[model samples]
Target: MGEWRRCCDNAVCGDNAVCWKSDGVKLKLQGENIQPANENEDLKKGCYNYGVDIADAIVPEWKELWVQVEPEAECIWFGEQEASKKPNGWWSFTFRNYLGKSVIRIKLADGREVVTDPIEVVSPKTPLDEQCDPLFYPKFLRTLIDDLIRYLVSLPFDWEAPTEFATEERTQPPSPIFVLHVLAQHADTICYALQTIWRNPHRRLVTEERWVLLSEASSVDADTILMMLHYPEHLRPYRGNSLSTLAQRLKSKVPERVFERRVTETLDTPENRFIKRFMDIVLYWCDELKRLGYWEKAKSHQPKLEDLQNFVRFLRADPLFADVSELTIFPASSQVLQKRDGYRECLQIYRLLHIARAPIFDRLQDAIDNRRIDQLYEFWCFFRLAETLAAVLGDGQRPYFSTLESDEGGLRRDLSANLGNGYQLVYNEQFEPIWKPKARKKLSYSVPLRPDISLLQENRLLVVFDAKFRFDEKDIQPNQPLEDEMDKAQQEGEIERLAKHADICKMHTYRDALKCRASVILFPGTKGAFHCTNGTKKDNPCLLDIVQNNGLKGVGAVPFVPKPEK
Candidate 1:
């Protein structure tokens, strides 16, 4: 203290501040205005540091704030974290809002966690340029992270490459790899992200690669992916939220570094060795269940009917599954595991062998014993054929019914309509109606709206569903990343669009189509926009926004944009 101050030299303040201590001191903050150089273990002695009183700092805009997070768990694309016993006293990560984030969490050993801090960023620099901002941390960067992570955490398996269904003719096999390209810029990125996770009619008809991209972007891991493949049938198709909200939640993962089966030979040759090897791995896991007396467990307690139903429904949750747990062909009472959700039952039996001493590898072998269906999700694959069967049976009931690529209207059409047209179609030059139909029966004219795509055949209703597409300049690809302003605007606009479509259709068209009764605009919705319309006012805009959050699983809509060029 004597030399630090140095005031004792001349009993006066030093001319140069250099006379102060050479090393910086730790400043303890006390209260709002006091800051002390040191603390003697007494709370009251600490000094108080006054924070800056900058303009508009109290309620700073979140858009200007960048999230600063430490490195999180990473996984290779389409890979998976091996399921293992979690540590005691530790709870598993809840994937509630993490739909868009990666699923295969490769957690730290213990006592490790992720923390998000805030970093101030100038709004001007937040934008993107055409030159592809190389190191940009775009707002939708999180989406890429989510997709990447999901793919990394979830493990995967594949069946015969070209499938053995058409083995007689050895021909070119479709490329198994699917890549989804999005405009390099941020503005369109958000909309593209939503399109991925949001379920659209005939989503399957879209090329497999596009679907996988969206699913991958949504942090849907391989396991969840398998479950999606085995989803149960429903009377109505899902139509609630627009595809955008679901996209923002996912993170991108590193691409797969290894390939499972790189095949060049024709399909008719001996069964692919890689597929056989994969089958072996699956079967090996099943063998252990048999050894544990799972086979001996009496079917007396479990009815064949209930078991089949349960199996189909069990794997509906996208986060779980494989093929049916077994590979056996069954009577309707005991159909092929591959024909339904039998894989769930197969995994259920594995709980019998979790003992510390029994090796996990041995359990795997048990699944493949005697080239059986085994205790894995192989049975889940049977679902893809449900639509074909439904057409044959014509019970007017099928396990699945879906649209194809042709189902989605052309991208050009959406661009023309949204960028230009309104509700009028004037083609009077051709052989038009000789005379306008008389203002017959009813004296009412209402604005037309969207139609009902979720109808069941039993309803005897023929509702027309016309989709509209919207294009944004933000979708252009760049060598570097660009800003995502358009995405924000689109999200806001989409909510309004869905409500407008629904309201006008329900009130006008469907009601006017004689006894048509129900007309709805099944459009895409944002995450928070898919709210319920309580007994509220008739004129509320974005009706879905008025009530509690349900979901956009069953909404109808307009046209679909094209695959991103980027």
Candidate 2:
């Protein structure tokens, strides 16, 4: 064992075994037994405690070892008196006051050096905390676009496709203008539909009055005679004011005069009403995009905006809609805008409007750029898993997965599969047990168990997976036997030895509390579908095989990498 340890220190750990600083006395590294950072715990920004342990290295009373931080950054280190504590060393340094990724390196007095795995500094959940590397922007946009496209594809036929943009083309290594193009195309379709409805508006006959010229040839009614007498020039043919001649002349001669007459009128139809309503919505979106600062970012879509303006102009110019004025206030209910012939297109347009109006869209760019990376990662996980499961079940046997629902907070999905046999598979996010056992002294309450993805068969949990946005391919390494012993020792110390990977600890909690067959932690990485499993049984837990086992138990971590471009 010493020889192995020596070999490991020579090759891997350098001159001394290096471990992460856990507390005042404990230093943990290279074992599953080491507890991971607590999820519920919060660490203040700036200076915090950090320490490291050196294995089998003799320290003579007082000596200092050099520690290096990569990317060539300087770190403040504690003095020799602090390092003299034989097996372990303590240090204090202020961390960078930002959230992102960094690495730490340690150099021993004997000239051997070891590098720690990448460490992620995460910030508390806030709108301003979403700073990320610029390189990830393109990938994030692609994922968001794919999710949206899938959502559109999943919609029922009644809500026709809002854009001519193909999902495949839009999702291909998205450009800065990609989102703009998508929104533009959607707006263009809506505008075209509206223009079609506006060209030939529905008309109805309405009774109205018009002035008509009456002549002597026209039948002389008593009203006409009185009207003609009021204007004497209308009876100019009769020169004398003799009663008998005037009476005789009145029967024979009368000049032309104007009088009000009833006639049918053509007015704008009900379809115009819907078109007008939709036009207002379009204009509002254009204004809102500008207000939300999307207009500047999406400048490439200026042509689309011009097209919308032209559509609005066309709607306003048509004589049928001459009286159709801008609605000062929109109806609380969309039902007021009745659907007609092109109602499907109108409905689709309304749907787009509804989406644009959502607050998520207002902060969509910010989310894609920073805050929603983890959420997008989770969404991608769900999408990939659902697709994989559907493929395994065959086209006819594909499970029905619900649309991803995202709020200001986060994302969720529901999925179910009926194999026609007695067996069934169901998946849900944030599932809660209907019944919870009551406590003798306190009120019973239900706690919601939210797993990123959960698989079940006939009301039995098969597997639960959590999506972790952090990149750590090394953490996925299988558990070592040395870890078991370390864990036992830690347990005797009255300190629980949780999984060194926080995500794994979370999975462990879900498995024990839910009593599910297995739980897995999923991470986003370049590694292609790596799976590590732990269980007492012989059968390995994969997506397809979990349903057959009666008492399957295990926990694992899988890396979900994007499929390579062909």
Write down the lDDT of every candidate, Cα atoms only.
0.23, 0.44
What lDDT does candidate 1 reach at residue 357? 20
Best by lDDT: 2
TM-score of 2: 0.49
Residue by residue across 1-566, what tens digits does model 1's lDDT show?
10122123333323211122212221110111111112111211211111111111111111211111122222111013232233332122111101111212223334342211111111121122212332121322222222222221121212112432211211322111110100111113222322322232011111122233232343445654443434322112333356434323322122221112222322211112222222333343224323433322222322432333233233233332122233233221323222223222332222112212212123223322211111111111112112222333234443321111111321111000000111111100011122325321221234322231222233232222222111111111222322233344356653323333334334334435423323223222221112112322222123222111232222222211111113
Residues 1-566, model 2: lDDT tens digits = 11112222436535433334311212222311111222112211101211111122111111123332222222222221121222233333222222333344444444544443443323222111122421232333344444533432332211112443211111122222223433465766767666666654556577444335653233444655566667666553544354446547677554545444343545444445656776665666566656644454444456776677677766656676677655555343444244444545775555444432222233333344443455555655665666565555444454443233332223322343443333333434455555643321111124557776766554556678777665355555536654664576467641212323445557767877777777766665444232324423332234455424543456665555553222
Please list the residue runs of candidate 1 whose C-alpha ends up more than 4 Å from where it truly belongs after superposition: 1-275, 284-452, 456-516, 520-566
Query: How far out, in Å, is residue 481 in model 2?
Result: 9.1
Would you estimate the TM-scores of all the predictions? 0.20, 0.49
Q: What is the alpha-carbon lDDT of model 2 when measured against the actual structure?
A: 0.44
**What value does the lDDT take at residue 101 in candidate 2?**
31
